[model samples]
Target: MPTEVLHRLSTLSLTSVKQLGRLPRLSSSLPALPAPRPTLAASEVPTLFREPHILSGYRPAGQPWSSYLLSTFQWHNESMNVWTHLLAAPLLLLRCWSLLEGAGGPWRLLGDVAALPLVLYVVSALTYLACSVAAHLLQSRSELTHYSVFFLDYVGVAVYQYGCALGHYFYGSEPRWRDDILGGLMGAVYLPSAALLAWMSCACCCFAKAHYRRPYPPRRKVVQLIPTGLAYVLDISPVAHRLLVAGDWQRDDDGALGFHAAQVVFFMMAAMFFSYPFPECCLPGHCDIIGHAHQLFHFFLALCTVCQLEALFRDFLARRAAILDVHGGELVVGAGVSFFVLVLCCLATAVWMRRTVQKRLKDQQA
Candidate 1:
């Protein structure tokens, strides 16, 4: 009876070990059963989204259309920046057309002789508008798109300035000594303006490109050529002395281009007040809305335009005085004073902009 009892006890121990081995299989099956397909955590959504429903399982990723739509609908910083200058285009066109209509006869047929300048202005404006639009809409899509468009926009502004200066050199003419003086003043105003425009284009293009694109590398050597090209083009003033005297070029004033190019560098230092701190000082959110560095720069440019116009008018008086009789000397003096003030103001603006930029940088660092 004792032997039978011991054998039965051993059989029960074997059964217990078998059940323990099976217990692991049951536990393993629990994980294999797919532990409740994890629902997305709240943290999984983008930080920009205030609500999950707004996200609706959408992420921008590589989607071009999504970025385009967001540019319009989203309350982004660039929204107003794109539109303000866009509205300026039609207004510019209307003004140009009206000026042409009023000129009459040969001037009307030539489309206001000023039309070439206007065309350059309109084209630059339109290109800038397109760039702003693209930057806002497509910049988010990829790094490559952003840098390219930004570079192009800078180029457009330079091209606009070049065209404006050329126009002044061509048209601000009169047949008197005072007219010659006035023409010289007008030429001074525009010549510097053109150079500054070119420098800005080249500087911004080289800087922005080098800094912005990292994942996608552009050929540095090719980009270096852009500034070189800008220098050559801007320095090469469209004016020839012979063109003014005989209505054509006998020997192009290649030297004049380099001379004017130097003047542009000086003006750029003065205008640096406007763009140096850039969006940080003016362009940021405030510039994006209404009063920014670009707008201020445009305002200064318009002032230059007015100064040139006054000089042109004085030249006309001087020329007419040579033909008829008018006080040309006094008019020339007044125009000179006005031009001096404009230059001083531009310098002041540059200084102010520099201080403002420094403050912002300090704040940012802090």
Candidate 2:
């Protein structure tokens, strides 16, 4: 194969950091400098800092952290990506707070362990958005920061998936589905498997990030996407089962079923954007600063979250009694502990991968 073709093919995937065949020899002495201008065209920035089909508005790598944060005020490629979640983060927080206040203020949540799932959902939502903001906003500071920031972002994604599963299992599931589906595997495998899948998703995504270099190959998407898709399927299975089973799909106490139904639709729509570089790939530079597919992904995802929060809150109000009556101890403590365990495991994995990234950087310097 030609050298360029061989290098491109090598980037399809890698088994480990050491397998980064002919690693891209990134600059090792980029100063912590300020932005030279508002933004650079794609040709000016490092390939690693550029986006697919995005031919302009690239932030220069190695700028001080504040430049990136301040860039939120400037129109750049990532401006919408940052604000989409940054703006939605506050709205989601207020909505959850309002629900808690109406229920008798924040202390009310503390009074009942049964509220842990809801609490987890809120935390997971906010955490993921915050992680995304940090990643997109500051990732340009350096290649190492890029990997580290996105490793954290990947953790947030997995954490959110697990939170969604907890909410679905606790609030959205029908009793019959719980007892009947897969011979009640949810009773035994749901939480543990969700946790495991969450960890796996995080690890696999980090691997893909490390395995592939920019400009990333087409197959790189599939490598990272498979694990994420698996995690989402597992995370949403409880609700999927409930929605599929006719016996309980008709039951609409508190009208949560409608909200749950809407969430499913929105999520599926969002998946399209998540999996493809659409609209943007079709018209590259035109969508650089706005109307980007990733921005669309965030928008649709936020819609999904809106529907999910409403449905889960409604269930908490109307279905909590029945759910509690059946499963007296929801293992609220164990569930909380499980989430933290996932957090620790993901952090450890991120840290380990980061060490590998640090080594790669050193090798490039060599």
Candidate 3:
């Protein structure tokens, strides 16, 4: 009887050990607890949502980086803003690659004096759009992140403008000025303009309280328009000179002038939407999800960019022989050096702005 009891006890102990082993496996197979969503403050989101009827899907500040990134898959106010440019960046890059690889009129002319600057312009556009994507995506993470991302976005715009000016200097017209003079003039005009835009963007992000209070305050609109106006002036001056002074309008392709006109129109529309915040201002909450002015602004800006590229390509095709024959190696080198220097300055400014934001945050916390 005692032996039988001991044997039974041993069997029971063995079964208990097996059950314990199975318990861990069961636990391992169980789903993990979902991470908590960040709690957002009212001010963290766009001011338009301040109206009770408008639902602002505001993500909380101080979210984990992984959480913010994962938020891309979720629906929010910024979802369209983030995805529009994010998806467009790759498409634009593919288009650029196709243009570079295809053998044809403008593609063949790519080896000419304007090739490098044109390439730079394409790269700058990609960079600007990519930065916009990043800024919109991660701006919700924290105030520091918001300020830093905005500064970077501004820098991206400045870089693209610099490239635009470089391309215009190199290829927009027949080389009337000496290569050195052209290079010097471009650097003088665009470098200061770029610097000013960057500074203004940083100031807008850092010190412009009106931006947070409303979408389109007159003061804020003026501040924003200043950069866009400066960019237009810089970009269009060469086109005007080509048409008016160089008499290149006669050689333009059938649709080139129309495309240029469309480009200007689109840019103006973007500015108007950006500055006025129309339709949404009128309808308020009704258009919150689908049809906001800022979204329209983005779409128009993209169209403007496409038109600009088309115009540039048309000009390139028309002036291929002259561009190839021109000996402007020194001008090309100067533009390249200036581009690098501008990029470095932008980086330094971004870092400085980031530090300033961080320090301010720390002070507030203290």
Candidate 4:
């Protein structure tokens, strides 16, 4: 009692001492407890802009710009859609560089015929892919952002389609004014149609907000197909005319015609997937993060671009004799000017779209 009582009295009775004694236990217990996992704020997690069955599986709705960006690293419906094109852009760009470098040097003749058209072809493909990446990634940012980016995406498609038409017109035929006149006539017919389709798509997106919701309306589906149908008409008419004039489908010595055929097939497949929304429609939610129709559409579109490039290369080789006879300097200048004009037009349209969208957003907010 004497020793125990003395020890107890010697021990501090202060609140600080009691708190100090508990500190080690609290520290030890913390290590045993699981760490707090990072979580998104409810508002940070996006909601679906479309119906569940339409996309299937889980889809993010609206989110802020930062979260929309960060979402790229996470699994979501648009993940594959974004990545398929994002990854393709660099690969296509590298292919463009390799093709351009190879066309130069001792093969200057090849460069003369192929260089500008090839460059334009790859650049146009890259533009579409890059725009697709932006549109898919930022779709959840806001309604304004979604519509704006998608408008740009449609414009990108129009630009690429026009580039394809121009490439065929420039390099597909012999370098003659008759061909040039023909090309100009074709472009005059198709380019304005493409532009109108693009405008129509933007208008549809802006005005028909309700069209995107639910059961995929028949009218909306038809309206959406109009631009694609126009693209098909523009892309196919010249090729069809060429084949008709050539009058020998079986004798494609360079396989350029065959490649064009394959390109059309791939383009059709892409369009089919885009319009149908296949296996996703059948299974519903099973392929949301991975094998959806939209992703398939992206894949097919990339393949179509590849086929187009191959066709361009083959056509260049086939026309080498004619191309060699022409004044290389003049041809180069003409092609350069054309490419510059195309780029300027695309950029101008983009700026106009951005300004229009911003104005509309401001008006809405006000």
Best by lDDT: 2
Tens-digit lDDT track for model 2 on 18-84? 3222222221233323655767899987777888888887788776677776666666788778877
TM, every model: 0.41, 0.88, 0.75, 0.69
Q: Give, for candidate 3, the lowest lDDT window spanning 10 residues.
A: 31-40
- Each prediction's whole-model lDDT (CA): 0.39, 0.78, 0.62, 0.60
- Candidate 4 similarity to native, TM-score: 0.69
Q: Which 10 consecutive residues of model 1 have the lowest summed lDDT?
A: 49-58
- Candidate 4: minimum summed lDDT over ten consecutive residues — where? 31-40
- Record all residue pairs in model 2 with backbone atoms less than 3 Å apart, i.e. clashing: none
The whole-model C-alpha lDDT of candidate 3 against the native structure comes to 0.62
Residue lDDT tens for model 4, 14-48: 32236335544553443221113222222344442
Evaluated at residue 109, the lDDT of candidate 1 is 32
Those runs of model 1 whose alpha carbons end farther than 4 Å from true positions after fitting are 1-66, 104-107, 110-118, 173-200, 211-366
Superior candidate under lDDT, 2 versus 4: 2
Better of 1 and 2 by lDDT: 2
Task: Put down candidate 1 lDDT per residue, 48-157, tens digits, no spaces.
Answer: 22121221212242445544444343333333344444444444455445544544422543432223333443454455455545544554343344444555455554
